[model samples]
Target chain A: MFKIAVEMLMHDKTKFLGLLIGVAFTAFLVTFAMGYFAGFMTRGFALVSENSSAKVWVMDPAVSSAEATINMSDSSLDSVRGVAGVEYATPLYLGDVTARYANGHFQSFQTIGVDDATLSGSPQPANLLHIPNSVIIDSGGTEGKLQTPLSKKDVWSYDGSHLQAPTRELRYGDVMLINSKRVVVAGVSHTIPRFPPRPLLYTTTSNFKRLIAGEKRYITFIMVRPVKNITPKELAKRISQKTHLKAITSDDFKKETVMWFMINSEDVGDMVNMVVLAMLVGFGVTGVMLYMFTYENLKQYAVLKAMGASAKQLGDMIFTQVFISAVVGSGIGIGIASLLAQIISSPTFPFRMMWFAPLIGFFGVIIVSMTAAFISLRPIKNMEPAIVFKL
Target chain B: MSKIIASCKDIIKTFNSGEAEVKALQGITLDVYENELLMLVGPSGCGKTTFVSVLSGLLSFNSGVCKLMGENISAMNDDELTTFRGKNIGFVFQAFNLLPSLSAIENVALPLTVASRKRAEILTLASEMLEAVGLSGKEDVKPSGLSGGEQQKVAIARALVHNPKFIICDEPTSSLDHKSGEIVMELLQKIIKEKGASMIVVTHDNRIYKYADRIVHMEDGKIIKVAS
Candidate 1:
């Protein structure tokens, strides 16, 4: 009977293909949207992820996430250093600065100023103390918007048109101006990409102040390492109580950052809407197609019923057909999505494939197919076997 | 006396249309004997089909007893009746009702498959039955590939594949030409004689009445006469 069901379903190639495509399209869109969402959430806390050695972060009470911050007075850093269970504390500066390339092209960059002595918040190769007035650029940006023009001639054509330049990546000894102050690219650091992609510059706190005019002498966050015997959670509690500021463990801070973005960002809402719409379309198309397929084959089902096929047998046959469609359609859809993810993934585009993406797609397709089968079961259940004589 | 293969006594069946009640079968009583080809001939809407459906347990009756192979069909639940039918009753329909997706042998194998017979045994039996119906080389051909006569032969093969005690054929020759109809009746008669099984054929075609061992005439949902 199951074999018969499969043969009947496959006999009409066009309808079978249509059903598969509907399911596959749904799976692909749902998976892609979910992967994009997961990617954004991961990149949301990239700053905290990079400075993993910092157990606790101290910021102003109004600061909700690492992306958005309020400046804290220099006394806060000193006060954090003096607190018990705090092994050492370093002041970190986070602000936006505009960099002018040699061709006079200006681009905005997010600047991170680690401590001059310890380089606490820097990415790998924290030897910034060896180089003076030099900054490290993120590798992601060096290949992207931060690439340097070879010469002024490359900025314009012979007709005086504003033609784009054929540029090269920023490398060591590349010079750029920040607030009229000259800075050399000391090294390129490979770091996780940020949410709203921006060129990154890592410099010492003193250099940051010189590069940005009229910048007050304040820090964005205090990165603290808890003493060996004390947990970061306990240390954060002590620091928060002592300074009357918001001090949280790095993990908690990452979750808080993601939550804040989920609530405040329209991008997340838009992605969620896309996922929901995809699921609805999947349900509607699959349901209608299965219903039509079953309706057209009701005569055959009646014949089987009159031939002494039990109701349970008929139900199993329908379920077998739906299960096959769901499993195969999901496989094809997720396979295509994985291939697309591989082809288009980049630092600028947030598309990370979490394990749950495929899982959600597979189970989501199953639910849709099963629901369709259930809906199609009604006519078969109410069918009179004696209709075989009439037809 | 020949063994009584099936019996129907004082059976009543009705249908409820909007604002009207249609009595399709009213007080139909008949007995089917082994090794006999019984034909129920009547005009359209005369309830011959309804009577056979009730006797075969494919339908329910409002009152009275219908038994097949000495088991009370009306006393059985739906599942029990279905199993009983699968094991004891065979059917050949006017349309030949072969699942278009399946080949000739597969269609012939349906009854045994419904009985959950072993796969190898089912194939062997289905193959033998198809060969017996003179569809030997056409085993793999779907119904669409066969002529009307060949398709009915396949339907007949399917009906007898499980060796049921009784066969119920409803207008088995209505869709065929006159020659094909004669051939189908001859095949059905030969097969029933060979197996010594009882049969109840409901048909309106008077041309094939000569093949029945006993003909039961029906009119207005009642059996009016029995002739041999």
Candidate 2:
């Protein structure tokens, strides 16, 4: 029966090709979307992921997203660092500040205040550890400009909030003049994202305290890394119990980040997957068309039935045909999806396609394929043996 | 008393196509004695085909007492009818009804395969039957590659493979040439004589009627004569 099943598919190559393309394309779609979603999702927590060196993030209970934060007293820092499972709690100060450049073009940048005690403390390419007056920015700087002079513009404008401006392009050792304070652009990095814009400024935690110019809270968030096999959840539970703030694991933060993106903003993860889903739906529609290829040939199925084939055997014929289409089409679809994903690769994209995505995609193809095959079988199942003798 | 292989009384079949009901068969009666060759002969639209289909357990009659080898066919459920048909009746169709994807021997061995026998065993049995049908050398060729007569011969081989008590041939030679048709008729006569199984052949081709030991004629739906 299997050999016959194989023969039925082989004997009709054109129909099989249609189904294969349909199934493979469907597989590619689902796989690509899931992969990108995974990849981009990981990036949403880049600040934490790049710095998961910290085991837990300490934030106010009302904080729903990474950007939505309230400060706890720097005094609470002592209690967090002193928790039983906690080896050390690094102080982090985060807030958005528009860095106005000398070029007159202003860009919104996030200022994270940290010292040598944390993971993001060390600047890549050039070290800013010794520069108490310096700040670090990503990949060149605003307008692909990096290693330029850093000078802060006016702070405490008419609104009484500290929104300082600096030079747009920052190269190493560049100095920036800010509101009543002088910040030297000591280090430049690439691809690390902050909340507001392309240019990120990292400075000493102490300087971050004095430069802010407003009544401050604790830290934007705390980054902690467990010493051993201690699960992040257990540690977070303990920390949450000890403090009045919420302590969340990095993975939980990642999920929250993705959910926040979905709810409040247009995340690249959702966009990429939405495109993939559209393609998969196209493949399903195409699969329905491919089924017509088999449906048109249903008279042949009736002939098989009249030849002493049981319902199972007849159904198997349709199954084998559908399976062939799924294997080929899914192969094509995933292959196309993967190739497309690779074609559009960048640090900002967070495009990640994995194997399981395609595996699940195959199930998708099989489901639609089987549905196509089964629906096609309706006409054949309704076939009457009485017609075999008809004129 | 000879074995009463099959009997039907007061059989009715109606088909609801659209808003109107088409009555194909009404009040038809039939009987086949053991080892007797019963032929259903009539013009077109005479319900000859419908009569055989219902008697073969492929169609359900609205009202009837239809029995195959004394088992009530009308009362049998679908699966029961299937099992009954598989055990007791074999069919031969005019268009040769061989699966095109399967080789000639595979076509002959289909009944055995449907019964869930091992391929090797069924193939061996099928080969023996093909040889019996004068098709000893053409076992591996599919139905499409064979001649009309050869295809019909394969169908005949399939019927006899199960050693059933009754054989149903529905226009088995209608699509064959005169020589091929004669060969099929002769083969059927020979097989019935050898196995002592009753058969009912529904056909309008009077040339094949000589092989029938008993002939029943029908028109519109009712049987007009039973000539012995």
Candidate 3:
């Protein structure tokens, strides 16, 4: 029966291709929308994802996601560090600053302040922290606004000695003004793109205070590591009791951030709308094409029915075709989507093809295809096998 | 008991099209006995096709006693009728009605496939039947790839492949040339006689009338004459 279904579909090359294309386009839209949404989710939790070593995060209760910058008293770090199950606690300073590059291009950046002694939360190695006025930049910014300028070939020159050489590019010793204070690029960090779509800059806590004045002690978050015997949830509970601040485990914090972004960000709403629109388009095309295909092959169905094929057998044949179309279309659609994701993938683009996203989309396509197949089966159900003689 | 494979007495079937009642088969009384080839000849819209449709258990008559192999067909539900039809009867159509997607052997093997026969055995049987119908080398060709005559031969093979007790061909040679028509009729007759199966062939081709064991002529939804 499945063989018959395939042969019937293949008998008319034009109709067969039309069905495939319809299903494929629907699959592509659904999968790509899911991938794009997943990408936004990844960026929304970039801070939490990057600091995966931290067991718990202590923040101002009002601060939700990486996009929300709520400053807490710097002394809150010591309170977390003093908890009985706490192994270590470090303050992470997050602030925004504008920097004018050597090309005189000024852009806003997410400046991260690392613990001076341990260089925790810093993109640079501990050894690189010794260089006074040193800073680390994200590679995502170097391609343009958010990428590291040190890696640009036309900008920097390699001198034979340790002394600074004449170069147009930002390098190990080049100075840039952040709030009238000069800072040097000592190292570079490669980081995934973030929600703000801004380049990342890392500096010591002292540098952060100097760059953004008006406060001597400001901490955005306290990254904590718990003792071996203590689970993150237990340690977070203790920290919250001691410091009167929100101390959430990594997983909870990730969920909190993603949820906050989903609720607060207008772009997220737009993205969700786009995903729904894509699904509607795919559903429309697939449903219409399958209905037309079944109607065109109604005579063939009549012949089968007249030849004593039971309703269940005929229904099974229709379902088999729909299932095959879904599987084939999803494979092709996912393949095309992955290719497109790869082609347009960049710091500025939000397209993340997660493994589970395509799996979910596959199921969605199956449901849509099956619904269409059922709609097409209605005419066959009512058809009297006697009509075969009329033809 | 007489060797009656199928019998219908005073069957009534009507079609209500847009408020106008049309009698397609008005009190049709007929019988097809075992091992006999019954040819029905009639002009267009004279109820020849409708009569066979009812006989094959496809169309339900409003009132009548229709029986096949000692079973009351009209009393059976749709599912039972379907099972009985699959096991006891076969059909061939005027247009060959070969599923355009399937090859010659696949079309011939459909009834057995529906019967849930083993694939290897059904294929072998289908091939043998196709060869018997003068389509030896054309087993793999689709209906579109075959000539009008070869397609009809595949249809004939399909009808006889299930080894049913009864076969019905509705104008099997209507679309073929005289030579092809004769070839089809001869094959049908030889196969029916060899298998000892009853056949009801509805056709208007006068050239093949001699091949029938008996001829029934119909007009305006009723049989008017019978010749043997």
lDDT measured at residue A152 in model 2 versus the true structure, 0 to 100: 41
lDDT minimum window of 10 residues, candidate 1 chain A? A154-163
Please tell me which predicted candidate would have the highest lDDT against the true structure. Answer: 1
True contacts kept of 3: 0.66
Candidate 1 residue lDDT tens string, B7-90: 989988998999899988879889999999999998889899888888888778899888888899899987898788888888
Tens digits of lDDT, candidate 2, A200-226: 667777667666767657477776665
The best-first sequence of candidates by TM-score reads 3, 2, 1
Interface RMSD score of each model: 1.2, 2.7, 1.0
Q: Which stretches of model 3 miss by more than 4 angstroms?
A: A6-18, A97-109, A125-190, A199-201, A215-217, A228-234, A339-348, B19-21, B224-228
lDDT of 2 at A385: 53
Please tell me which predicted candidate would have the highest TM-score against the true structure. 3
Spell out the clash pairs found in candidate 3: A141-A146, A141-A147, A142-A147, A142-A148, A155-A169
TM-score of 1: 0.81
Residue A155 error, candidate 2, Å: 22
Taken over the whole model, the C-alpha lDDT of each candidate is 0.86, 0.73, 0.84
Rate residue A163 of model 2 by lDDT. 30
Per-residue lDDT tens digits for candidate 1, residues A206-287, read 8887786575656999999999999999999999999998899999999899888878888767767877887788767876
Worst ten in a row by lDDT for model 2 chain A: A147-156
